[model samples]
Structure formats: C-alpha cells, structure tokens
Target: MIAAKFQTFLILLTVLAGTALVARRFNIAPAILLMLSGVGLAFVPGMPPVELPPELVLLMVLPPLIYSASVAMSWREFRNNLRPIVLLAVGAVIFTAAMVAAATHYLIGLPLTVGFLLGAIVAPPDVVAPLAIARRLNLPRRLVVILEGEGLANDATALILYRFALAAIMVGHFSLPLAAGEFALIVAGEIAFGIGVGWLSLRFRKWSRDPQVELTLSLITPYVSYWLPEHVGGSGVIATVACGLYVSWNGPLLISSATRLQGIFFWDLIIYLIEGLLFLLTGFQMRALYEKSKTFPLDDILFATAVVLTIIVIARFAWLYPATYLPRILSKSLRERDPSPPWQWPFVLAFTGVRGAVSLAAALALPFTLPGGEAFPYRDLILFVAFGVIFVTLIGVGLTLPPVVRWLGVAEAGRTEHVAEHEAEIAARRQALDAALKSLDALTAEKEISDEVMRLLRARHEIRVNQLPDSLDPAHHDVSAAGTALTRSLIDAERKFIHDLLRDGQITDETRRRIERDLDLEEASLANREYREGPL
Candidate 1:
C-alpha cells in the first residue's frame, strides 16, 4: 500500500508540473489548468482513483501554506487596513455563511445544519488563486494587502464555524452562549499557544547558529504550531497564522541572513509543490462526486449548485460594500486616513473571493457516519456542490477578474505608489553604500584590514553608489537604469567564465557550486536593491 501510494503520488507530481508549465506558457491561472488536468486524468482507463483525505490536507497541506502566507504578508499594511481585514475576515465570513445557509435551506430545501455546514465549507476565499494572480497584475497595494490579510485569517473563522455547525448536527442541539464562549476561548488559546511556540522556535534557531538546522526548524515550526493548539482542542488554523506572524516579525532580529535566504527559496518551492498538488486534488474530486451525485436527480444537483454558487457570490457583495464604506462614513478620522476608493475597487474585491483548496478539503473532511451510526446528511450532495462552487469561483470569476479590472479602469491605481517605493529603494541603496564605506574606514583605522583591501572595498561601494539615482528625474532614472544593466552584464560575464572553466574540468564540482552560490547571492542582492520579492 505504501509503495503504491508513493507511485501514485509521483505520477500526480509529474502531471502537476506538466500542467503548471503549460498554464504558465499560456498565461492562464495554473490552478484552474491543473485542476482540469486532474479531472481529465481521472477518467483515463485503469488509473487508480485519487482521494485527498481531509486529515492529510488539514495536517500536511494547510499548516505550511497558511504559515508561509501569513509570514509573507506585510504586517504594517495588515495593520493599516485592519478595519477592512477584520470586516472581511470575521464579519464577511459570518455574513456569507449565514446568507448561504439561509439560501440553501429555503431555496435548495436542505436542513439548516447541513446548509450551515456547506456555508462554512465555502465561506473562506482561498488565498492561493487570487494572490498568485494578483501578484502578477498591477493591483493597488492596499487592495492586495487587505485581500492577503483576509485570506490569511479568514480560514480560522470558517473552520471554527464549521466545527460548531457539524457538532450541532451530530449532537442535535447547540447553545448560542456556549458556542460564543468556546469560540472566544479557542481563539485566545490559539493566539497564546502560537506566540509561545514561535518564541521558543526563534530562540532555539538563534542558539543553534546553523543555517541548515534553522531552516529545518522553520519547516517544522508551523506543524508544531498547528498540532499544539489542535491537541489542546483549539483552532490549529489560528495557531499557525499567529505563529507565522510572530516569527516573521521577529525573524529579522533572530535569524542570520544566510538562513533567511535559504528559508525563502525552500518555502517558495514547498508552497509551489503543495499548492499545485492541492489544485490537482481538487480536480480529482470531480470523479468521486460524479459517481456519487447520480443518487440525486441530475437537474436537482445542477439547480442546487447554481443556487448555492450564486448565493455565495452575491453574499460577498452584500457584505463587502457595507463593510467597506460604512467605516469611512462613520469615522471622520478613517475618512481622512483612507479616502474611500471608487466603488469599482470594492466590486473587484468582491469578485475576487475565489474559493480553492481549503473549501474542497473541508468538504471532503465531512464525517462518513454520525455518532448515532446514521449516514452523514447530504454528504454526497455537499461534496458535489462544494466542488461545483470551487470550479465556478476559481475558474469563472478568476478568468473574468483581470478583464473586469481593465474595463473599470482600476488596473493601475498603484502607479504613483510604485514610483515612490522605487525612489525609497534607491535612497536606501545609497545609504547602504555609505554604511559600507564607513565600515571599511573603521576596519582600516583598527589595522584589522590592510589599506589595499579597504581601497578595493571602497571602490566597489563607490561604483554601486554611482549607479544609484539621487533624484526621480527621468534623465537620471535612465542613466541609473543603464548603469544597473551594465553591472548585471558584467556579473553575467563573470558567470560565463566560471561556467567555461567548469566545463573544461578546471574546477571541482564542489568548487563550482560554491562559486555559483556566491554569484547567485550577489545577483539576488542586486535584484533586491531594485525590488524585494518577499516570502512565499
């Protein structure tokens, strides 16, 4: 069984990689493409059925994905947009779920608990699809930040609500006050436990002083964050997000530069693989749903899917506009701080609530049997609808989002901010050059470095300093850009020489690798001076 599982996993990985490449080449959303590929593969002859067990997704997939996203989010921006983030993450989730439940109960004729269960499954927008596409688009930074913050935190609310609704179904009773208290306690415990775990992990990594060891610890930290709170009957999603935020904020002070770089690349690759697999698994779900959904009339299933998906989409708009404009209307200070964006921005945000891996995982996690030994209510129907909603939102809305942005003329509101940020980066580079020069002077004064070494170091810094623009003047900008290009070309020439030497067997493989690592780091430093791509 183990070997067979491994083989199947390898096959899926290959398929994911292939689909991702194709999607990228065509500039299409890879999640949708990969999912389509999975669905097609499912129907192939003699292929083993693919199943993504909920426990596996919640345990293995959710933690690192959540942690990486939370860490990558700009804490400053998240704080700045706290009002919207909170409204969307907490308020929007509740509102959407409630509306979905009501619609499902009345329009689709499902029981209230089952409707709530489906609501909870579909409530949280999956960050993966929107974020991946948004990064490529020239979205307003504030919009991106709010979306990311909501994505990072919203899962916790939806998952907690799902648990409560499921429990209510199984036990045949629930108390509002009790549920409220439990919710508060779970959130509190998750926050406290996550912070405690993150602090300890950070300290341990600092003490070890080994980049590889620290990287390994970073990999496991999210899992530990998740498991600890879960073991104590708290929300693991909240625990992981809190832990990620704390560690990322403190990491610059505690972690070495080498470890930070390595961690970034490692987490990027990990997320890419996991995210691809998730979409693939989502597609695989269609097969199982196809077989089971036949128990219900096909037209009824279609009706439920359309009604549920429509409700989910409309519910977002219902919550977003009030959530967005109300605060600015009510608070004079807020109005000044965040001038209300045009109505189109909120509409775009509402449209961007694309659901993905999380919803599918939650749906799949439904219990097969209740404690009373009765088959779980609407299990097949729920799965079908969940898959249907994911497809509609992830593919349909995702495809339309870019064109809609163009149509609304809201595509490039961040242009001025982007320019200002670039100016800041150049200024920082100049300061960095000055700092390097001062450090060389100090070393020379202490006789710790020879005059020749100091001069060489000073010269390099001078060259880099000369290449940076002192003003935002267009002519100066052109010169600075040209100089940067020249610098990169010189670096490329050095790399080519090294490659030639290695091809001619002049250096050992290990030596070549060491040299390549240095060159890569240098290139990364140069690229970051222009623009930093943060964590995954």
Candidate 2:
C-alpha cells in the first residue's frame, strides 16, 4: 500500500510538471490544463484511481492557499474595497446559495434541505483560476482586488452556511435567529483570534532570528490560525485571512531581509505545488464519482448538475449589478467618494465565477450516515453534481475569459493604468535612493569613515540611480531595456567562468559558491527592476 501510494504521488508530480510546461508553452491557463490532464490520466487503461480525501483539502490544502493570498494582498486596497468585497463575499454567496436551493428544490424536486446543502457546496466562486487569468490579462486593479478579496472571505460564508444546512438535515431542526447570531459571533471571534495568532507568530519569528526557524514558523502560522478556530466550531478561513492580512501590513518592519527573500521564494514554490496538485486531484476524483454515479439514474444527475450550474452562474450576474450600484445610488457621500463602475466591470466580474476544489471537498465531506443511522440524502448525487459544476466552470469560463476581456475592451484601461503605475514606481525608487544617499553622506561626515569606502558606497548608489529610466518615453525605456539585457548576459558569462575555475581546481567549491551567489543576487535585482517597468 505504501509503495502504491508513493508511485501515485510520483505520477502526479510528473504529470503536473509536464502539464505546466504545456500550459506555459501554449499560453494557456495552467489550472485549466491541469484539470484536463488529470481527467485524461484518470481514464488511462490500468491507471490507479486516486480518491481525494475531504479532510486533505479542507484541513491541509485550504489554509496555506488562503494565507498566502492574504499575505500578498494589499491591506489598504482590501480595506478601501471592503464594501464591494462584502457584497460579493457575504451577500452574493448567500444569495447564490438560496437561488440554487430554490431552483433545485422547485425545478428538480430535490428536498429543500438537501438542495440547500448542495447550494452551500457550490456557492463560492474559486478565485484561483480567475485571478491567474485576470492578472495575466492585465485586468483592472480594482476588479482584481475585489475578486481576490471576495475569494478570501467567501469560503467562510459558504462553509458556515453549509454547517447550518447540514445541521438542519441531520438534527432535523434549525432556527433562523439562532443561526444568524451564531454566524456573527463566529465571524467576530475568528477575526480576533486570527489577529492574535498573527501577532504571536510575528513575535516568535522576530525573537528566533534564524532564517530557517523563522521560515518554519511562517509555514506553521497559517495552520495554527486555521486549526484552532475550526477545531472550536468556527470557520477557520476568516482567522487565516485576518492573520495573513495582519502579517502583510506589519511584517516588513519585523521580518529580516534574509527571511523575507527566502520566504517569498518558499511561499511561491509551495503555492505552485499545492495549487497544481489540488486541481489535478480534483480532476482525478471524476473517476470515483463516475463509478458512484452509476447508482443514480443518469438523466436525473445530469439535470440537477445542469440546473445548479446554471443557477450559480445566473445568480452571480443577478446579484452583482445591483450590488455594484445600489449603495452608490442610496448614499450621497458614497456616490461622491466612490462612483459606480461601468457595466462591463460587473459583467466581467460575474462571468469569472469558476468553481473549484472547495465545493468538491464540501460535497464529499457529507456524512455517510446521519445520527439515526439512515443514509445521507442525495450525498452521491450532490458529489456528482458538484464535480460536474467544477468541470464545466473551470474549463468553460477559464477558456472564454481572455476572449471576453478582449471583446469588452476592459483591458485597454488597465494597460494604460499599468504604465502609469510603472512610472510612479520609477519616481518612488529614485526618491528612496536619494534618501539613502543623504543618509550615507550624514554617516560619512559624523563617523569619519574611510574615503575609499565612502567612494565605493556612493558609486554603488549612483549606479542604481542611473538604472532608473528618465521617463516612460519609448526612447528612454529602450535604452534602459538594452542595458538590463546586456547586464544579464554579462552575469551569465561570469557564472560560467566561475564554474570553469572551480572545475580546474583554481578555486574551492566554497569560493565558487560565494562568487556565484553574488552574481545570482545581482541578476535577481536586475530582473526585479525590469519587472517594475511593466509589460511593453
């Protein structure tokens, strides 16, 4: 059994790497390719079927993904866009769940409670695919922010609702006022606990002062924040998000430079692996679902899946337009402070409602038997339909989003704003460098540092200042680009020469590594500078 599981793991890693390469080569969204690849692999003759455990996704996979995204988010931006995010994250989730429940119950004749359970499973739009596609396509920053913010918080709403529906079905009773009060308490408690976790984690990392230990702490922080609240009957998502946002806002001052650099690479690679394996595993479950689905009438399952899928999609569209404009129309101050966006903005937001692994996990997590020892109603059917929804939305909306953006021409404004952002970045860099130079001058005057050391330090600062383009004009940008490209080539040549010296015994391996590390840092710095210039 161990060997088989190890072999399956290797197979998944191999497939993941190959599919990622294919996606990059063809300019396709990797999530879409990965899902399709998993499906294809599942049907291969003699292939072992992999069952994705519900707890694996809910406990192991979710926390870090949410935390990493939260850490990457700009807290100021998130706060500024809180209203829309709440509208989508909380209001839209409940509205969509209600819509799905109504449609499935009335149209398809599923029991109301069972329909609602399915609704909670499929309500929240998975932001992973949409955000990846949106960022690559250079969609509006505010739109991306809203999507990201919604993704971070919506899981909490949906999961809490899931619990409510489950209790109503299993225990055969639920109270609206009681559920509402409990929901509010959970949100408030989780947020406070999450922030406390963040503060404690930061203090420990700061005290430890070792990069390896700090990285370990960072790795565990999300789980600590997530598991505690969840273990105590709260939705852990809010706590994780709160912890991440707290870290993002305060971490720069507390975290060491070495830890920050290492942590960025560490988190990026971890997120990449986790997200890739998640989609692939999600796709693999189709085989198991297909087998279980045989117990039900095929037409009934198909109809229910289609109905739920349609309701979720249409529900987003129905809820978003009013959500976008209603607050602005009602409040004079809000209208003045933040005017309504164009119709295309809401349309694009609505169209990006792709479901993912979370829903599948929720459905699969349904208990096998209720408290009275009766089989769970519609468990198999719910799982089948949830998987279907993931399949259709992930592939359908993922593929069409690029063309939709193009057709709507929303990206043109984003592109223009992107260039302006780069220009502002250049200005900021110049100012920061100027400040550093002044500090250096002050130290030189007060501390009586050697003239040689001062000269070299000043020269280094000057070189960095010179690297910034004079303006975002085409000519200046071309010159800066040429210099950056040439610098990279020169760095590559130096690395090769260093390796040759090590091979010939002219330098020790340690010596070669030290030199190579410097070159790597320099190359990385150049790449970062170029990235700030934005896509041409």
Candidate 3:
C-alpha cells in the first residue's frame, strides 16, 4: 500500500511539472491547463487512475493553501472592504446555496436536503485558480483584495452549511435554532483558538532565532490552526484563515530577514506544487465520475448539469449587483465614506465565480450510503453536477476575465496602485537607512565596530537610498536613473569577474555557485530598492 501510494505521488509530481512547463510555454493559466491535462490522461490507455481521497484533500491540501493565501493578503485592505466582503462571503453564499437548492429540488424532483447539500458543495469559489490568474494579470488592488477575502472566508461558510444540510439529510431531522447556536459557537471557538495558536507561534518564533526552525514552524502553523478547532467541532478553515491573518499582521516584528526570505521561497514552491497537483487530480477524477454516473441516462445528467451550472452563474450576478450598490443607495453616511464603485468593478466581481478542488472534495466526501444502508440519494448525480459547475465556471469565467477587464479600463487603477506602493517603499527605505545610520553612530561611540567597516556599510546604504526615485510621478523616472545605472554596472562587473575566475580554473564550480548566489541576492535587493528596471 505504501509503495503504491508513493508511486502515485511520483506520477503526480511528474504530471505537475510537465503541465507547469506547458502552461508557461503556451501562456495559459496553469490551473486550467492542468485540469485539461488530467482529462486527457484519464482517457489514455494503460494509465493508472489516481483517486483524490476526500480526507487527504481536505485535511492535508486545504489548510496550507488557505494559510498561504491569507498570510499574503493585506489585512488593511481586507478590513477596509469588510462590509462588501461580509456581504459576498456570508450573505451571497447563503443566497446562492438557497437558489441552487430550490432549483434542483423543484426542477429535478430531488429532496430539498439533498439539493442544499449539493448547493453547499459548489457555493464558494476556489482561491487558487482566480488568484493565480489575478496575480499574473496584475489585477486592480481592490478587486484582488475583495476576491481574496471572499475566497478565504466563503469556504468556511459553505462547509458549515454543507455540514448542517448533510446532517439533515442523513438523520432525517434538523433544527434551525440549534444549527444557528452551533454556528455561533463554532465561529467564536475558531477565532479564539486561532488567536491563541497564533500568539504561541509568534512567541516560539521569537525564542528560536534559527531560520530553519522558523521555516518548519511556519509550515506547521496552518495544520495546527486547522487541527485545533476541527478537533473541537469548530470550523478548521476559519481557524486557519484567522491564524494566517494574525501572523501576517505581526510577521515583520516576529521574524528576521533571513527567515522571511527563505520562508518565501519555501512557501512559494510548495504552493505551486500543491496547486498543480490538485488541478491535475481534478481532471483525472472527471472520467471516474462519468463512469460512475453511467447507470443514469446521459441525457438526464446533461439536463441536470445545465440547470445547476446556469443557476450557479446567475445566482452570483443576482446577489452581487444589488449587494454592491444597495448600501450606498440606502445610507448617506456609507455613500460619503465609501463612494459607489464603478459598475464595471462589480460586474467583474460578479462574473468571476469559478469553483475549484474544494467543491470536488466536498462532493467526493458525500457518504456512499445512508445510515440504514440504502444508497445515498443521487450521489453520482451530485458528483456529476458538481463537476459540471467547476468545469463551466472555471473555464468560462477564467477565459472571459481578461477581455472584460480590458474593456472595463481597470488597468489604469492597477498602475495607480503601483505608484502608491512605490511611494510607500521610498518612505520605508528612508526609515531603514536612518536606523542604520543611528546604529552606526552607536557602534562607533562604543567602539564595537571598526571605522573601515562602518564606512563601507554606510556607503552601501547611501547608494541604495540614492537609487530610490525622489517622487511618485512616473515622469520623474530619471531621478534615480544615474545611481541605478552605476549600481547595475557594478553588479555586471562582479558577475563577469566571477565567471572569468571560473573559466580560468581559479575557482571551483561549487565556489562559483556560492559566489553566484550572493551576487544574485545582491542584484535582487538592488532591483527591489530601485524605482526603474536595471541591468543585472
């Protein structure tokens, strides 16, 4: 069993790498391309079928992905858009689930409880696919924040709803008042647990100055957050997200630069691998789901798929438009404080409702048989319908977003945000340099360091300061042009000298690599500090 599992994992990794290469080469979204690849593989003769265990996906795959996203999110932006986020995350999900459940139950003659179960399965959009595309497309900051915030929290809402509905279906009973009380308790427990875990993790990181140890803790944190709340009958997804947000807000003070840089590389690589594997697995499951549902007529399945997908798409738009505009229309204070967003913004948000692996996990998690041993009602049909929603929305909305964004003229908003970021960078760099200067003075007064070392350090930081643009105006690009040019020339000179030494056999290949890494880090630091692009 262990060997078989290991072999499957190896195959997954190979497929992930191949899909990533193809996606990059063809300029396609990796998540979409990976799903397509998986579908192709599913049909291949002699290919080993890979099943995604619902438990493995939920417990192992989900927490890290959610945590990575939450930590990277700007808490400030998330808080700023709290009203709209709550509307979409909580209200829109419940609304979409109700619409889907009603349509399925009435139109298809399924049980209402079963309909709601499926509704809960596909309600929340996947964080990985949309955010992946958004990052590459350089989406407007506000839109990105809203999407991220929605992704992080909506899953919790959907999962809780799914639990309630599934319980009703299985046990033949449910109480709204009881469910509401449980919901409140779960939420409170998750928040308190997340905060407690985050505080302990922060203290541990501060105590252990080892970067390697810190990275390990960082990797374990999400699982801890997920496990603690989940063990106590709370929402693990909410716990992980809350922990990520708390840790992210306090990270600068808790971690050192070495830890930060190393951890970024580790998390980025792991996230890429997990996302690729998850999407590839999604495609592979398509054939299995189809085969399992073949007992039902194909025409009936198609009709159900059409109904569910259409309802899901329309429900989002129905909820989002009014939700976006209604507060401004109703409240003068809200209107003055937060003016109405452009129509295009809300339209784009409404349309980008792509579902992902989480939905698949939920559907696959559905019980195979009820408590009395009868077959779970419409299990195959539910899986097929869930898959339909994922495929249609992911492919449909993913493809349409770029053109719609261009038409809406939101790229300028992104550019404006970039300029503001640059200004903030400049202020941060100024303070950093000031701190260095103060430290140098203190060191000299105490004779803790030599004058030669202080002089060299000061010169390096001064050059970095000079490399920063003097103002936020794009037209002022020339302000740091001279300093950046000189810096680039110096980096190039170092690189050339290093290579020459390697060619002349004065430095071993290992030595060359060591030197090259340092040079690359230096160039990266310089590029980040500079306003405009520079030669490496």
Model 2 C-alpha lDDT per residue in residues 1-536, reported as the tens digit of each score: 89988998999999999999999999999999999989888999988989899999899999999999999999999999999999999999999999999999899888888888899999999979999999998898999999999999999999999999999999999899999999999999999999999999999999999999999999999999999999988889999999999999999999999999999899999999999999999989878877877878999989988899889989999999999998889999999998888899999999999998999999989999999999998888899899999999999998999999999999998998888888888788888998998899888888979889989998899888888788788777788788889999999899999989999999999999899889988998988978876455
Top candidate on TM-score is: 2
- Model 1 C-alpha lDDT per residue in residues 42-146, reported as the tens digit of each score: 888887898888888888898999999988876677777888888999899988889889998999888998899899999999888998887666777888888
Using alpha carbons, what is the TM-score of model 2? Answer: 0.99
RMSD of 2: 1.0
Q: By TM-score, is 2 or 3 better? A: 2
- For model 3, the superposed segments whose C-alpha errors exceed 4 Å read 1-8, 434-454, 471-514, 526-536
Clash totals for all candidate models: 0, 0, 0
Best by lDDT: 2
Provide the lDDT at 55 for model 3: 85
lDDT of each: 0.85, 0.93, 0.85
In order of lDDT, best first, we have 2, 3, 1
- Predictions ranked by TM-score, top down? 2, 1, 3
- Which pairs clash in the backbone of model 3? none
Q: Worst 10-residue stretch by lDDT in candidate 2? A: 527-536
Q: Which 10-residue window in model 3 sums to the lowest lDDT?
A: 527-536
Candidate 3, residues 332-435, lDDT tens digits: the string is 99999999988888887887899999999999999999999999999988888888888888888778777887888876688667767766867887898889
